[model samples]
Target: MGRQSPFLLQIGVFILFFILQAATMRDRIIGGREAKPHSRPYMASIQFKGKNICGGALVNRIWVMSAAHCFDNLRPESMQVVLGAHSVTAQEPSQQNFTVQASISHPNYNMETLENDIHLLKLNKAALVNDFVRKISLPKQGEDVTPRRKCIIAGWGDTTDFETHPKALMETNTEVVSRASCNSSWTGSISQHMVCATSPDNVKRGFCSGDSGAPLVCMNRAVGVVSFSSFRCANPRFPDVYTRVSEFISWMEDVMRSF
Candidate 1:
């Protein structure tokens, strides 16, 4: 029997369809460095039907960063974000979990072109900041995170295609790839608003499915959000694409102020 039931599979497929159509990426890969519990308190897990559907990061007291595709046909109230948690299954009473109050997909989001793949979530209440819960700083305006800059991607995604979702958080260090290289690898589908990263030495150490919306952080600032990948997982020729956070500072600031 599958880990997810038939009904869950249907919902998962439906949700994943939007994820695919919007981002054109495969699932996430696990087994890297372990994320520091305090480094990513805003990091969250999105659960549906007893299975993790996606990953997200807290932007503010009530806002989270995630891919728009993850919200396909799903309402804000139906989702919950488990924050301040090191592992998804950790039953620590100290974990701060919040119900979603509202979800706003980017107005210019295009499923076909995968443009504006970002989304914001409003929490019912403010998340308490503790040892395991702290907000990650957003990249400054006009900040440029170029190729070869070391960054980290973290999630509770699968270790491999045939494997089930990981029970704990995992992270890996990767370097940003150049725009020219990214364009070449993605066959010209790359955009100025998107960035790419790959593992060193062409190793299979990058984001996969179920990692959508997780942060691509560097220098204690969030630079990108995991958006898409090739079907083969972390192939050297296919760099993982992410929504460039620095380019969307205005949109993010505007949305956050409304809360």
Candidate 2:
């Protein structure tokens, strides 16, 4: 789950619904099953004061990608990234913890509209890659996920609305929703910078609170960053929205190179 920044400013009436929706988003993988231990090596548990607050993907040995909203009002010094984690609550031997040397949110990020919600965290030290810890591949610049494509979302979020977060990672399969359909459902608030997905069988199975900043893995590539969902979460009427990572490939490359 993620916290809404206090800097949320009014953009327009059309965007107001999204602004309010974002305020209540916590980010979880609803209706997902437990992931196999060490199966998602790239998954990163973003923590603050040793508490899991958000999820992320290890894109490189030194760089972790997440949602910009997750770091709002949070300091880098207090943040940590735990890689190779299957059970976030366990003191697993394979888990590698790293201090966040820096937290960089996209320059053009908008707290109100939830646009450009991508973020990156630089690790204090390079990760030691191994069988249970490795980086995931990134999408090509400007690459777009086609409608109806199936993708997997994994995180340490609750599987049900009332259930407490499980110790093991959870994941679910979702199908990409077309921009037009998603925009219609959201009243034209869906932007090109974002992507939408829903359960293939129309089940209420998608992201909810606590899964923010988690990667939407498609074709073995990290294609989207969990942004926000309806306040009701996993509601069929409102599909989950994500920051289209391909749209910010250039920005991410620049940040990694300059920093």
- Cα lDDT for residue 9, candidate 1: 86
- State every prediction's TM-score relative to the real structure: 0.86, 0.89
lDDT of each: 0.79, 0.89
Q: Go through the candidates in order and give the C-alpha RMSD of each one to the true structure.
A: 7.3, 7.9
Error of 2 at 169 (Å): 0.3
**lDDT accuracy of residue 238 in candidate 1:** 87
Q: Model 1 clash tally?
A: 6
Tens-digit per-residue lDDT, 1-259, candidate 2: 8875555544455488766666545757888898988899999999988878899999999999999999889999999899989998889999999999989999989988899999999999999999899999998888999999999999987666554668799999999999999999889989999999999998889888449899999999999999988777788899899999999999999999998
Model 1: clashing residue pairs?
Answer: 25-229, 26-209, 27-208, 27-209, 28-208, 28-209
The best candidate by TM-score is: 2
Worst 10 residues of 2 by lDDT: 5-14
